[model samples]
Target: MLPALAAMVFTALLPNLDQWRRHELPVLPAAADGSVTFAGARVTLVELSPAQLTTYGDQPFELPHGVMAWRAVLRLESADPTLNDYCEIALEDAAGRVYETGADEISRARTDFATCKADASPAPGASPTASASPTASASPGAAPSPTSGPDAASGSRVYETVAYFATPVGTEAVAVRLHFPSDAYHDYRLTPQG
Candidate 1:
C-alpha cells in the first residue's frame, strides 16, 4: 500500500513537460497578410508601411512596449558543420540608438528564441504605448480584410524573432535589427528602420 501511494504521489507531482516548456518557450508570431515567406520561414511583417502604422489592428502590427518580452525563433540559413555560427537580436529607437539582446558576442546559443525584455524605459519622445498591442481588435490570428500585395524579399538571411519594447505607454515607432553574433553582417540587416 505504501509503495503504491508513493508512486501515485510522484506521478502527480511530476510536472508536465509540455506545459513547463510552453510557459518558458516562445511561440511564433501569427502569419500576417502580404508578408513574404523567406527560405520556407514566414517573415510575418515584411515591412511596416506608413498606412499600416497609422491604423491600429491593421497591416502594421503595434510595436511592443520596451519592457514587454518578445520571442522570435531564428535559424541559420546554412548551418556550418565545423563551426557554430553566432546570431543576435537587436532593437533600435527612433533616434538611432541600438539595444542588443540574445546570444552573446561569441556564441549564438540561447535557451529558446531570441528573447528581449526591456530592463529600462525608453528615452523621452521614443516610448511606445499600451494602446499599441497589435492583436487588440481581434484574436491574434484573425485575417485582415484588405490583403496588400507581397513585397519583394530583401535577399538577406531571415530569422524569426519576437521582441518586447519597454517604454512609456505611448511610443509610436521603433526599429529592430538582426545580426550574426560574429557581427559579420553589419549593414542592411536591421528591420523596421522607418
Candidate 2:
C-alpha cells in the first residue's frame, strides 16, 4: 500500500515538474528589519505617514470626506536602476482586504514614479521604462519624489516613491505587498503600523 501511494504521488508530481520548479514564493521582510529584496532590488519601507503629511506632486492629494489617506515611502536600491522591474504595489488590511493602486484614485494621482511597465522592444529612440524604479529628480524638501539612498557614496543609488492610499477616516493599512515583472511571486513587508 505504501509503495502504491508513493508511486501515485510521484505520478501526480511528474506531470507538473515544470510548474513546481517555477513555483514562486513571497519574500517577506524580517520583523526586526525593514528592508527586503524584490526583483533583484533591495526594497525598504522608509516611512508610513498620515495623509496630512502627504504632499504628492505639486498639489496635495485630495480625497472625499470621511476618507483618510496613508502615505507609504518606498526606497528601492539597485546598481542598475534600469534593471528594476515593474512592481505591483498594494496595501493590505488586517482583514486580508487589498487595495489595488491601479483600480482606484491612486492611479489618477500625478506621481513622479513611472506607472507603466517596461516595453521589451521600444521605438527607435524610445527608452525602456522601469515602473518600479525611475530616475530620481532633484526636488528640494520633496516628501518622496526623489531622495537619494543613504549609500550615494557607493556606486549604488536609491529611488523613492510616495505611495498614497485613501481609506475610511479611521482605517489604516497593516501591511504592503509588492509583486514585480512576474505576478507569480511577491514581497510582503509589514508596515511600522502593522
**Candidate 1 C-alpha lDDT tens digits along 108-155:** 212223321111222234333222122221222111111122332343
Candidate 2 residues 1-194, lDDT tens each?
Answer: 99999999998888357334323455465346566565556666666666552234556656666766666666666655456667766666667565555335444545434321222232233333322232233321122212244544255545565566666666667776665556455446556523
Best by lDDT: 2
Candidate 1 positional error at 107, Å: 20
CA displacement after TM-score superposition, residue 168 of candidate 1 (Å): 3.7
Q: Pick the TM-score winner.
A: 2
Give the lDDT of residue 183 in candidate 1: 34
Q: What is the C-alpha RMSD of each candidate to the true structure, in Å?
A: 16.6, 11.0
Distance (Å) between predicted and true CA of 134, model 2?
9.9
What's model 1's lDDT at 69? 29
Kindly give the number of clashing pairs for every candidate: 17, 0
Q: What is the lDDT of residue 56 in candidate 2?
A: 47
